[model samples]
Target: MRRRRAAGGSGAGRGLRRWAAAAALVALLAGCAPREGVEEIHYRLKWLYNVSTVGDLYALEKGHFARAGLRVNVKPGGPERDALKELELGHAQFGVASADQVLRAAAKGAPLVVLAQIFQVNPLQWIYRPDKSPFREPADLRGRTVGVTFGGNDETILRALLARHGIAESELRLFSVRYDYTPFYEGRVHFWPLYINAQAPIIGERLEKAGEPIAFLDPHRWGVRFVANSVITTREMLRQHPRTVSRFLAALLEAWREALDPANEEAAVQVLLAADRETPEAIVRRQLPVTRRLMVPEPPAAFGRIDEAAWRETEEILRLQGLIERPVDVRSLFAGNLP
Candidate 1:
């Protein structure tokens, strides 16, 4: 009986040791595995996929968000989609919006916060044949036919420009602009509003091919700094998921810096082409350098620096134009200390 008991005890002890070893091995494997708290976030863009969103698309394609343990769903915005509204309804955790949009929303009591200013210089500009327009000064705009999208930000900018230069609306013929560029092509309109990076390359290339010399009248050169697209989130999101916001921004801005780097031009172009198959590769190549110039014109200027002055100017423009009912303290809308 003692022998039998000893044998059973020894078998039981070996079985327990094996179980312990197996448990330890499982734990060891788990410890070495990738961390498991991956967050799923929805990010909405102000516009469709193009050179404008190259950095955004690059971040997703290159696994920047994945490396940061985030699963981001990047949704493109159009005329029907409003990023500010998406943020308000919890449809998106992060979104891109223009300064004017942000200000208008804040004026109407939206809890929005600006994460980063994407474009250091606004892309909206007037394209014209310098030979025909001879737009040497704002005064040159007087007695000329200019195209303006009546209710769009272009009108706001044009109004502000004329206001700044003391050029009244009656001084210039404000031609209503639409999707068709026939007026500009036929020289009926002296200056046409087109995004310098998006539409300029296509239109300018066509004009250049036709032996027409083109020049862009930059409002920034005349000191009309209406802020463009910017990364935005709700005040609640910033407060609740500060870490996630920081990580997302860090990943995004890192991707932007890399995407804008001339060294990575081919790779960035590939990314943009993959998302925007409609745009010809040649045009994207042309568009990218212009985008890089607008976003990071000076090498020393930070890519996502929030231009407070620009924001204030944007708000003041909105206020003076009666786009917003009252003043919105622009400073309250920015998350200046971004990671």
Candidate 2:
């Protein structure tokens, strides 16, 4: 048999063929670009894209929104920062946040509605120093200082967990800790709430790099569950932009699909590391897999499907704990063009 020739040939023909291939691929994709229902949207995430907001960041970067003619602006979140205010103040039209904010906003007359549950299972966790002031569990938190911020449903979660475990708020002291995990390392608090996707890995990798080992404790295993961050929009925006919502969700789901790919793990880590450049790659790698696992641990395979049961369960938890009154519309929770 004759030996196979190299595909692009040599010299000038090789250069010409490579250019032609690149041009053709661009033309093919541009030719397939969406022609209908384009919308300009700003997406302010409740937190940066590390763990909490990676789903949105990945969706935005992968052209999920582009095929649907939607442009999204994803802004990161922080302490004393309100994403809903960003939308209400007309800085952004869409964003991700916890339902607690939605309830608080609705109670104050913002007419915001949750659209999608990004993390179906709560990713909230507790981080402690086993070598220092090591915490065995929530019970160990009694009479000890813990660092936390007053955002989302954090207090409600802790209280609910306390009641179940027969722990008392009076037995523990709350210290304000910045969202970062430094306080735990410095012996400022006995425990701190963290998102396993973002903080856990960052802390783990940083400490490991510094020769400081980190210990993680799942609060949910101890009966602490908080509503995960969710996609939300003002009712006014939704009513005037139903098509936009559908398009946005479509693109977001596509991003989740890419994240679901096992081979894309490293690529996904790079995207996440883009969120916090100060964070090490090892941390990002560790966090991304945990976040991905939450999307759909098992799979009949709906990548970004909103779970009404999960939403209501969270609502019930909030209500029984008096975090919300009556009920918020679960149907209005996540709007889509799906049947």
Candidate 3:
């Protein structure tokens, strides 16, 4: 959904915008040619530029990938992009995709392997205005209009949440969400799905300005934990270019660590703003902390660490939802140690 802008007088916002603009220029020049002996690696993302991709941008801008002898072409993904399809067609050496996509691809005999888990907690959550018919529990969803992306992961997750709480589909209204947030803005929908870090800040800002504070209904908190974005590559690439995989993972993990570092907050946010000019600087600055929390949920949580249990749960959800007819050996897809 959409929301109005929130006013922020922080000087950090202006500083980041300037740095981001300069960094964009530098990246543009750097993309013109590869450094000597640097192998070109095409990495496709799951979606467009946002806080979700700060680590990827950080790695590119700070020479992390170049330091590993690779010139990565970080491509943005959208409705027209399918990372797994590109990987199968030999278009991209590496890409980011959700766990469900990997599982479904594996079930269909695509030799995809998970390299590292990006989000420790899934960022998909239903946002609602507390002043506008707040839901205290899952059963409270009965008779409420909930917006979900039809045939998307959110649809599956929301269904699972309903089943978990013994709430039947007939009791609630399931509205298909799209790029247009008119229905939500007009108060026709009680809750809407959005990436907590990407769209949440913008929606929350707008709603807050209208005197309606936004709150999120996280499925993870209610015991239905769906896995989010993770790094992926084909088994062929991992086996043939084992060295490249190792180098890429090392650099990538290091970049993620840097992006989540408190000292590097401004730098990371600036990189994201440079990549995605559509999002306001203030919104991006607010998203960085949320991204950090999802990336590293707790202390001693290593960056890029794969949570096996969460993977299993994701597979189960897909199977239960009949998204996949047969079970995919999700654990076998990972090589385990990541740098």
Candidate 4:
């Protein structure tokens, strides 16, 4: 599914043009608007319907937002509307975005707090031509055309990989190849950043079935670290509606758990197909396993728990990449704060 750009969040790290095609606002069908007697909450999406970007659907599907007494309106984000501004102006009661985006929003005093780290791993796959050409390793990408979306996790990973190899941005022909799969397939560039939630595996599987194949070189496997996406909210919401936040998180975790189950998988795909109407069912289905992998259990934690060790590594990558000037104390962006 395509992520329709909402608000100002689709900045430097964004790749895809956020596109919401067929999904109607479900709340609208149920007569949900800012009604006089009914309580309402607006959710500003980081983008429309990317699989990893499904906090709204997940939360709502499991009754988390409804349990919080919020008649949630899922607003598709765009390049012009700022998610932070929407939250600030009370246009949105909550937002579904990344920990990096929350950090930027909080730095601007958006009153946001990260309630949970949804994806334990940032699924960035540094993709190269399957022909096994010059872009085989981190050091090999010095002057290649490397593409990643702005505001997405791939930015952090790309910068970190460059830094690890001691390569300057000046040394490479870096281009913003928004999150479309055509660039690599047509041989327009040598390498591009990918997420398992987005492009790499879906196309890989499709091509393999068609008697052609491509492969992904995971940057984390080469000493790069970044997590894909997470659940973030405002600080006041955390403090004032503490139980509400907790309930929402619990419900969202439940949805995440169900999304991982093999039996319940088809229903989850149905929700996705309905939302990102432009994307094919095959592509959306292909992205599910990688998305499920994000919900896998960590050693000292249960399923759907965020791993601190992974986040610390991500922070280091962001700092080295100059995305975060210096690492703010990491204590602020983890579990245990919702209520």
Candidate 5:
């Protein structure tokens, strides 16, 4: 009886050892699995994949977010897609939106927060033939036909520009502009509104190849500081996941700095090409430098640095234009004190 009991004990001990080893092996395999500690979040862009979103694409392609233990779903924005709405619907945690959009949403009681200002200078500018227009100042715009998308931000910006220069809308013809560049191409419109960083390269190349001298009329040069695209999130997201916000912004801004660096020009171009196959490589290359200049024109003006004065001007512009029903306190819109 004693021998039988000893054999049973040995078998039980072996069974216990085998069970422990199997559990340890399972734990080791789980540790090796991907996304164990990483948090996944969605980020919606203000526009489609283009030179404007180079840094965002670069961050994802270069593993910046992953290294920071974040799995980001970088989604594109377009005419049909509204990033702010996505945030409110809980479909996205972070998003990019123009200041006017933010102000309008805030006026409607959207609990949005601006995390960072992406473009130091607004990329929206008027492109024209320098030889034909000879625009030396805003006054030069008088007696000329200027193209503006009536219901779009360009019109608001154009009106603000005219107001700043004491030029009335009646002074120049406001040609209704659509996607077609026929009016501008045929010289029917003297100045056309297009994003300097995105559309300028393609259109400028076309004009230059045809021996036309081109120039850009910058609103920033004229002191119309209507703010542009910015990074945003909901107040609840900021409150609930402050650490994630910090990590995401840090990774994103760092990626922007690297993407805009002259040393990484080729890499940035490649990243843009990967995301935007429709844009030819040459045009993308051309677009990148302009984008860099718009986002970071010089030192002491850091990328993603919020210009509070610009925000105030943007809000005031929206209110005066009646785009928003009421004034949104621009100060309350920023999540500037994030840890």
Candidate 6:
């Protein structure tokens, strides 16, 4: 990682001032609010409006957060948004981030902590027209051209998967991918990274119309369990407003439970369609079930249950890949003490 000039002096001073201002503003606003007044909060998501954010969208639309006395302004994230940075700047009190983002931010001394684990199964996977190339097993990747974002978590995951399966780096062609999925559509890239529920389904429908079937290769299914999206907030926010944190989490988790329930499938899809108008209605409907499976794959386990083992495996993979020089204790970064 290249060192920014802001590492010290004026830059460091500015950052501290911003953080202090944010903290003070939160305290002042919280203290002055009436006992029954709804406290307005901002939530920064990991990506743009999509099915991946159905739980959040549902919560907001269904008045779950309102019942908890919180009026949250849900913000959309994209390639330009950094949830952790927004948290530090006090732009957002809470946000969603991946495990890799948390680990990297902590290594740089960011005062962030995990509030809840949303995705039990990481949806990051490679989608391919199985009939075209037939990616039935990890061994099939050999001699194939695979696409991964050069510095994204998917790179770490794909590398780990290859290493675990004893596939030499020299054997396969690794292609660095951008926002475009043209290569995959053109069949130049055999496998491409995408969220299983989001882009995969959209592409699958296109292939289906063209007489092709799509299948995804998940690292988690192959034993590389990287943690996915989780709720995050700054240490200062957690320390200063314990009740707010608890209420927010409770309502949010309950919202996820309700959204994933089979009875609420139609309502959940409707909420998502409202939030993401570009996604076809039928595609959003298809995505909801796949999103539910990834969010709460393990039965008997409640929604938002933090999988400590998955976090540990995520850290271990980063360490092996030389991403984290000194492993930050995964347990310490969690807000809820995991047993």
Please list the Cα RMSD from the true structure of every candidate, rounded to 1 decimal place. Answer: 18.6, 17.4, 12.2, 8.2, 17.6, 3.1
- Candidate 1's TM-score reads 0.87
**TM-score for predicted model 3 compared with the true structure:** 0.87
Tens-digit per-residue lDDT, 1-339, candidate 4: 122322444442231111111011222222343432125656677666668755457667657667656666767776666665565544554566656665544333334566666667667676665654455666777667777776556666677777778888788776677656677667677676766677676667766776754666677678765655566655545554555556656766776777677787788888777778887898888888877776576566765566666666766665555555334545565546433
* CA lDDT for candidate 5: 0.83
TM-score of 4: 0.75
Question: Residues 250-283, candidate 6, lDDT per residue (tens digit)?
Answer: 9999998999999999999889888888999988
Q: Write candidate 5's Cα lDDT for 1-339 as tens digits.
A: 101112334554554454344334333433443634225677999989999999999999999999888889999999878897677656677899999888876776667789989898899999998888899999999999999887888888998999999998798998999999989999999999999988999999999889999999999999899888999987666665677778899999999999999999999988988899999998888888888888884667778989999889988887777677667889898897433
**Which one wins by lDDT: 4 or 6?**
6
Rank order (by TM-score, best first)? 6, 1, 5, 3, 4, 2
How many residue-pair clashes does candidate 1 contain? 0
Score candidate 5 by TM-score against the native: 0.87
> Cα lDDT of all candidates, in order?
0.84, 0.65, 0.82, 0.61, 0.83, 0.84
Model 1 lDDT per residue over 247-328, tens place: 8999999999999999999999999988998999999999999999889846576789888999899999988877775688
Candidate 1 vs candidate 6, TM-score winner? 6
- Model 2, position 67, has a per-residue lDDT of 68
Flag regions of model 5 displaced more than 4 Å.
1-38, 337-339
Clashes of 2: 5
Per-residue lDDT, model 2, residue 311, is 61
Candidate 2 vs 4: which has more lDDT: 2
TM agreement with the true structure for every prediction: 0.87, 0.74, 0.87, 0.75, 0.87, 0.90
What RMSD does model 4 have? Answer: 8.2
lDDT of 3 by residue, 111-134 (tens): 677999999999999988778767
